[model samples]
Target: MDRYIPPVGRWKLARRTQQMTHSALRELLKVAERPDMISFAGGLPSPDALPLARVAEVTQRILHAEAIGALQYGPSEGYMPLREAIAERFTRNGSPVRASQVLITTGSQQALDLVARVLIDQGSRVLVETPTYLGAVQAFSQYEPSFEQLASDADGLIPELLSPAQLHDVRLLYTQPNFQNPTGRRLPLDRRRQLAQLALETGLLVLEDDPYGDLVYEGGPLPPIHSMAPDAVVYLGSFSKILAPGLRVGYLVAPEALMIKLVQAKQASDLHTAGLTQRIAHQLFTEGFLEPHLHALRARYREQCKVMLTSLGLHMPLGVTWTRPEGGMFLWVTLPPQLNALDLFDAAMQAGVAFVPGAAFYAVEPRHNTLRLSFTTSTPEQIRRGIETLGRLVTARLSGLS
Candidate 1:
């Protein structure tokens, strides 16, 4: 008898399940968790910056003050007070954002999935930044859209190549214009305007993901593309960076008509984001905890970034170059053509450091010579040690010594 035929063998998974591959970054982050390894792999915000004491206070206050409201099931559109608070944030920033246009999500990731579910048919054309957010790529892939790479430079996405002809039949353009992950590049004012102009001209929709916008170290906020072309954009924001990520609250701003469909999509997914967390977030924002907490976080990341940058400059061999990020937790590094980041992973982990290879960020034409380093998780001393270890390893590889 053939070994008992498992019932699961007869059960085929969805095509999307077949398409899903393990996240290299997630696996690397786990390797980074070893006690002795100094990891620059994860995009985690600094743990010290989490307002634990305040969270404790707020937890007590919310439960004692509004237990019934916190525990109850909420609307698919999100808790009403949080929706109003988010809308007010947009209004205060010079955009006319109405509460009616907002939809709260489990996280901004859910927003991405909802957009893909409601808007994308299989094989629909979608424009994405070259080396875009890995999570966005994963979320959007469920619908199996044909992805087109938008060229990017130091200033971020290049709108010139994305002319009207290129955009015909394009379902949506996904981008992270501020402190973009994996690369830590931000769009300048001119590029932002050009992107908005191109989208408006072609009547294309833009999914603007901005989880790291507030992580800008020292500068005024860059006006979101949605602000410039409100009707043509869906904007996503998250509290994971400023506040604790464990809360799992994020939202999307889109036109009301579009939002109705997205809310329905969301209803099918999770019914709603957690009511307790949403209400707690609303309370925190109303009490003005975000701005001040963000200032302290920026300062911490700025100093950590400085240490990492300085260490890289001091130790990294020639043929290795890295981004000097103005804000955000990460910087991108490019090694020589001969040194492949994916190939170097084992050596890196063995040498007491771990990082995400840059190949995972690209939708097409992945660069094997590149990698990303996150600066927020380590102490300045740990950063120095980690960079030095990495530098020594690269030098050895280039010299054929290890």
Candidate 2:
């Protein structure tokens, strides 16, 4: 019997850009959901760190007092009060920015997307750190920019390495600048100034995504690059790490010229982020709840970082290099060149631990020998167990390679 199949017409599909799909770090979190798997893959703030009680209280107040405003659609630029609060936060951090400069986004992820949409044309040249935030790359990739990876080290992006030739046609330079994701490297004060100077000299635009700055475990916070070269840098900040990620609240600070364009782009994107979420975030900030809350986050993450560091010292093989981050959710580990981290991932997963292969974080020519291990989500005991398992896997692989 012949089976009747539907006739296939020419497939109407997405553009070349849309055809590419990138997986999120959260997808690898499936391992943690299994109860048996200990995850070192999630770039998450500690669950215990979220100000749930405060959020619940503030949310209840917002719903009861301003039901219509909370539930109804908000201005494309965001609720004014929240923008003011965000602006004040920036000023308090030594970056004197106005509320008009702040464009509330669903998350910093949205800020990155909107910036990409507004600034990037097809095939526009863009500069990124050697191993930067995978999410930023995913967001920017939709615009089809030609990514030029700049070399970096423990201090973050090397300013001297960014040549004038690289700046010629580059539309934007994307950087985390503080407690960078995947690598957990912070750009030092000197380098931060140098970068600002370079941007000023070369006329390059900078997109500064800083979600983890408030969670600094040690050292005084440096002024944002935007503070030095306000016109050249587009600053992205988030309440996710300090307050709660579920709120999905973040903001972008751009020069008036750039923000005007981004506001139109954002309005067309999501109408606006949920009004209730913005209201709740504003209430928390205005009611003076964030400072102590941030303190708690710092303390907890510091202890967790220590746990992971101790575990690594005890378990990791000699000659393996790993970053010792002052603050943030991750540490980047570079294995011996003979060992391919992607090849080792399955063995680590089978042994009940999971981490992100660093190759995925690179925009081009992935470094197969590196991987990112997150320490924020797992417990100390789980960290110890997972690292021990990972260490054994590495030992066996290295031995076989030898």
Report each candidate's C-alpha RMSD, comma-separated, in the order given: 3.2, 4.0
Q: CA shift at 55, candidate 1, in angstroms?
A: 0.9
Model 1 alpha-carbon miss at residue 316, Å: 1.0
The digit string of per-residue lDDT tens for model 1 on 63-111 reads 9999997898889999998999999989998999999999999888788
RMSD of 1: 3.2
User: How does model 2 fare in lDDT?
Assistant: 0.87
Best by TM-score: 1
Clashes of 2: 0
User: Each candidate's TM vs. the true structure?
Assistant: 0.96, 0.95
lDDT of 2 by residue, 380-402 (tens): 88888989899899988888877
Worst 10 contiguous positions by lDDT, candidate 2: 1-10
The C-alpha stretches of model 1 lying farther than 4 A from their native spots are 1-7
Q: What's the residue-level lDDT of 324 in candidate 2?
A: 90
> For each candidate, how many residue pairs have backbone atoms clashing (under 3 Å)?
0, 0
